[model samples]
Target chain A: MFKTTIFTLAIMAPLVSACGASYAPPTQRLADAQSAERSAAELGANSVPNAQLSMKLAQEQIAQAQKAMKDGDNLRADSLLIRAKADAELAIAQAREKGAKIEGEKAVDDSAAQKATNVGQGATK
Target chain B: MNTLRNLGLLCAFTTAAGLVGCAANIPPQDLVTARSNYERASKGPAQELDPADVHAAREQLDVAEAAFAKDGDTQATRDQAYVAARKAEFAEVRARTLQANQTKDRVVAGMHADERKAVALTSAELAQTKGQLATQGVVLQAQAATLATEKQRREEAEKRAAQAAADLAKFATVKQETRGMVITLSGSVLFASAKWDLLPAAQMKLNEVAAALTKEDPTSKMVVEGHTDSQGAASYNQDLSQHRAQVVRDYLVTRGIASDRITAQGFGPTRSIADNASPEGRANNRRVEIVVTPAATP
Candidate 1:
């Protein structure tokens, strides 16, 4: 029983060492998070309240992920980067929705104004 | 037996941990929330006001639904649902904002149009007013011209009347009669007794009279009448008066008076101005009378 326990412990130790050796920096996740944040900002996320808040959260998470990467905590950094990317994507969606809505409203208003001007000109004529 | 038992327990623990780590169950709550949010957005203002946002949201929701269906209870499914939910909420916010902006834009545009119309109306009104003023100016100019012509006519008439009065005072004893201005000259001063010859001094007086008559009205007609006393035979007196009147008319004609404008007549012992029984009265009765009629247009 003692030999079997020692053998099990030896097997687990090698597996744990192998897992620790597999640590890689979250470069791809960080890039994805930064790309998502840039897209959100381009979509005017910072102009809306809810979307701005989400963008801020994503920014903080990405900062945290950078810190974790600096600290050699690749797993923690990867997780934080994923979360940041998701938040940034959500922010982008929110911003795009708001922008589209504003554009639609502007179109309707422009049409109405044009009609009104045409009628007024006709009346004058 | 104890070592084997320990190994089995360890194996069971490892298996349980592995199962826990790989438990990719669908995030039912998140999926439901995402689906609800998407449905609400699709039916609400997002559908029309923000079609692009709505389309994005729908696409995210579909991805989430697919993820969940393909890998239920997985991190990928949860992530997809989270993103979908966020997109749905974003779509609703965007729709509301867009609608509000549309209304605001419409109001602003309407105001601008009204302002533009007002400006155009003002310009037109101003142009009309200017045109009216221009017409009034033309009318005023015409009236001014008419007034000027009337003033000139009045001035000309006044000048002519003053000149006629001056001529009457300087040269002849003028009297207004029904015929026109009558100038009386003593027959004794114009001719030698019963003779048809004018005295040299009488010629100067006649020249002055002729000048005054011509200046007064160049186109006037003159009648020369010879008067005589009642002392002689009517035939002899008539012959003498006619010859004397003809001499006076001929002398005026020589002094630039048109012969066509002078007519001579003799009245002997007729139309006397005074009683012929008195010498002084006879003297006044034997006078030459010149009557001048003014021209047709003064």
Candidate 2:
């Protein structure tokens, strides 16, 4: 039995190392990805149509990462968390872009309205 | 037997590792996308507006490329490439957001400047209008003052004319005629028969008339006329009347009436007012008449 165990380890070592899989838990990676997802949500990522796809993708990735963790595939879970983090960050960027675009448009309208109001007052006066 | 089995298992695992290597000959779609995303991001405003983010994206793409070179089509390689692509997209999005923010800032700044300019122009206009109003107010005040002075002067002139008329009526036979106010003095009282000199009693009455005439408006004009009855020769009577009119005019001038405004005229029996057959009528016909033309009313 000891010889069988030694043989199995010898065969698995190269494959495991080639795939860069690890036995250590990906708890920190999971926390990082969850934090990013929360930040994206706080920025109203889901409300922005341009950011919704990214938000959905991030959620899916995070769920898959959790499943990988439950199945004892910690290295795979870490990899999935990395993808989730990227998606969540992309969502945040898209949401910010939308917000900034709206702000820019509003500034233009507000400037025109102010000009119009000033002209009206001048004419009446 | 165990050593031989271990050797066989090691050879099998080595062959599987080789097969995995052979399968990774072509790059995965994820790596291809990551490379394109990085290239596009570098060429876009992301490089200039967000250099650090672009640099991070570039670094992530490099890592993905390295993984692809080491293990093509491997899950690790694909995952890294996917993350790199997302990083590049993040850089692009962040740059866009920055651009939008800058546009808003520029517009808002311009708006404020326009508002300030409008306020300045309006203030200048208000100041100019106020200055014009001030000047107009001064002109209106001056006009009103001139009008008031003119009204007071007219009122005083009217009062003076009325007082002069009242004084003349007290001592003389004052009458309104078409020409003007006439004050008639009997020739018998003013001069002796055929004499041109004024009698002493006539001088006193003439003094009172002179005082009233002097009180009249300075612009008024006066004429003194002498008349006679038909008893004397026509030429002699005309000469006597002429002398009598001149004497009365000179006397009035010496009593303070303006000489330039008073003139003397003479008329013999040709212009008598009554019949020569009656003594009282002839008496009335022989008279000295003073006519005063008042100043024109305002």
Candidate 3:
């Protein structure tokens, strides 16, 4: 009977190793997603419609990733976290672009006002 | 023996998997991009122009660095880097806007200061011009007063000269001589023949002559000369002529003329005006002449 138990253990070892090799926790990915979402919000993502939408989607993916982690599905959690991070990056890019455009417009307006002041001063002289 | 060999193989496989899972991941390209962006923004106006945005970017970069340092978290590091890059970009844009506004404000303030200075200078110049005009007015008033005083003095002098000329014409034959004005009085009309006393009519005529002399300039000296005809004895005529000149001087002194200004002289038959052989010539030679000398001005 001992010989038979040893023979069974040898056969199950490869299966256990294979199963253990596939086990990768999504802790880093979830943390990354959360960090990206926070950064996007801090970058004024909520001020733009498209950026706000992207940020909202990122938040939902992060929530789903957390749920998957709790259900003991590390692969699914990692995949969801990757999608969340991508959405957050898109939101950040969109917000920055919008801020840049606004800044450009403000600069143009300031330059025009300065030109007007110069012309007024010349006329006064 | 077969069981022991299988357990060793399982131990080796598990150790290899644990090593792979625990190893630190290499920094991703996104993380590098985020770092580069953060550095560029820090070196730019982000640090001073928009400190709040720079601080937020710094926080994300810190998280990314920490996650990268902790093993087995490549995704977290990459995501953190991506977020940090965007935050850096935002900080740069915000800083640029803030810096531009500050520059524009400074320029406007400088222009205002220059305008204020120009106004102050104009006010100062206007005040100076007003002062100059006031000074010119004062000078013009002083010049006008001086001219008025000079005109009044000239009119007074002309009036005095006219009065003097009219008074001299009244009682004497006046002439402009080298000594000054000469007035001649006939001796026959002034005194009786061969007598030294002046006639009553001669005294009246002498009074008018004294009045005219007094009306002349006060700073003039007079010489009174008495002349007689050649028919009289020299000694007797000299005494009579001296007495006659003394009487004329005495009359002038009583009429308010100073005695020191008159000199009495007797030229008895010595210097005759005409040929003393004829009666009319002798009559002309017997005359009294008054010579006026102007006093020297200082």
Candidate 4:
């Protein structure tokens, strides 16, 4: 039984090492997620309500990914980074949408003011 | 040794069953969600406005679906499906952002168009108003010119009247009476001793008098009275005075004084100024008086 146990250990050791070597550390993916998060922050995503929620989620996922990477769970870290990038992108999109909407509203308001001024000038005349 | 072999064979068999079970059963929750998300995104505005982004999302979804088909319920499958779902959502969001930008552009274009139209209209109105104002200005200028011309004419007429009065004062003894202005001329200066005709110097003086009298108000009446000294017989002096007054009146009329406005009268010695006993008094009494009655007096 002891010899069989030693043979079983010898047989599993290479398999475990192969499993560990199969996953590369998600360094590039981590960098990608960090870069996306930075872009979202630079876009003032935290100031917008809809983008703020997505940014918060992205931040938490990035933290979780870092922890996963430290724990040597490359696949889990990569998975978390994927979610982080998506959330960050969503935040950026939301911020952009909000900016576009504001611009549209401001344009409409300016047009209305200009029309009103024209009408007032005509009336005085 | 047989126990270890049997354990390895059982593990192999369990993995095979698990793979087969995963294929026959439903997809993972994340993959299912990603499939739904892609379906919604495809139908959304992303399809038209951000087709490239939508195509990218579809490619990512295909990768996730391929992973799910190959890996069964593995963590890689779930992670890829999560990424795919987020990509689909991102496509939708990007499309919405693009739509918003398009809306802003349309609104801005419309605003510029309105501004241009308003400027054009305002320019037209300004031109019309300028034309009207210019016309009114011309009329006002014409009226001002007419008023200036009329004022200058009145001032010149007043100056001429003042000059005529000054010239008349040179040779005439003029005085104001209750009836009118009285202009007196010596009888010896007008006629010789008993002659009824005027002297050459008298005629020249009478010309000035006639001009001055003509400058008087057109509606005024004038009377020329001939007086004689008391040394002569009343009837003879009266006849001579009458003839002399008539001659003076006729001379004044010929000099451009109105004949209709002038009449002659003879008051021979019946009226005298001084005691008539002295020579100077008799000379003063023998004079012709031209009386002008203004239009206002009866």
| DockQ of each candidate, alpha-carbon based | 0.11, 0.52, 0.04, 0.56
Model 1: DockQ vs. true structure: 0.11
Worst 10 residues of 4 chain B by lDDT: B163-172
CA RMSD of all predictions: 11.8, 7.8, 14.3, 7.2
lDDT of model 3 at position A53: 87
Q: Candidate 1 at B72: error in angstroms? A: 4.1
* Residue B156, model 4: Cα distance from true site in angstroms: 4.1
lDDT of 3 by residue, B1-298 (tens): 9999999999999999887765555577767887888898899978888788778888988988888887435766776776787678667766765665565566656666656765676677789999999999999999999999989887877675666556546645678888888888888777888777878988778877886787677889999988888886998888888888888878878878899999899989998879999999988888888888898776
Residues B240-287 of candidate 1: C-alpha lDDT, one tens digit per residue = 888888888988889888899999999887979899999999998888
- In candidate 4 the C-alpha lDDT for residue B98 amounts to 87
Off by over 4 Å in 2: A1-25, A117-125, B1-23, B155-298
Q: Pick the candidate with the highest DockQ.
A: 4
Q: Count the backbone clashes (under 3 Å) in each candidate.
A: 7, 0, 0, 0
Model 1 reproduced share of reference interface contacts: 0.18
Show model 4 residue runs off by greater than 4 Å: A1-16, A19-21, A123-125, B1-25, B72-74, B112-148, B175-298
Q: DockQ ranking from best to worst? A: 4, 2, 1, 3
In candidate 2 chain B, where is summed lDDT lowest over 10 consecutive residues? Answer: B163-172
Q: Rank the candidates by lDDT, best first.
A: 2, 4, 1, 3
Number of clashing residue pairs, candidate 3: 0
- Where is model 3 more than 4 Å wrong at Cα? A1-125, B1-132, B135-139, B185-271, B275-298
Of 1 and 4, the candidate ahead on TM-score is 4
Interface RMSD of 4: 2.3
Over B1-298, each residue of candidate 4 has an lDDT whose tens digit, in order, gives 9999999999999999998896646688988988998999999999998888789889988998898777677778888888888888889989888888888898889878877887888889889999999999999999999999999997877777667666667766788999799998899888899998789999888988887887788899999998999886899999988888899999999999889999999989888977798999998998998999988655
Q: Which pairs in model 3 have colliding backbones?
A: none
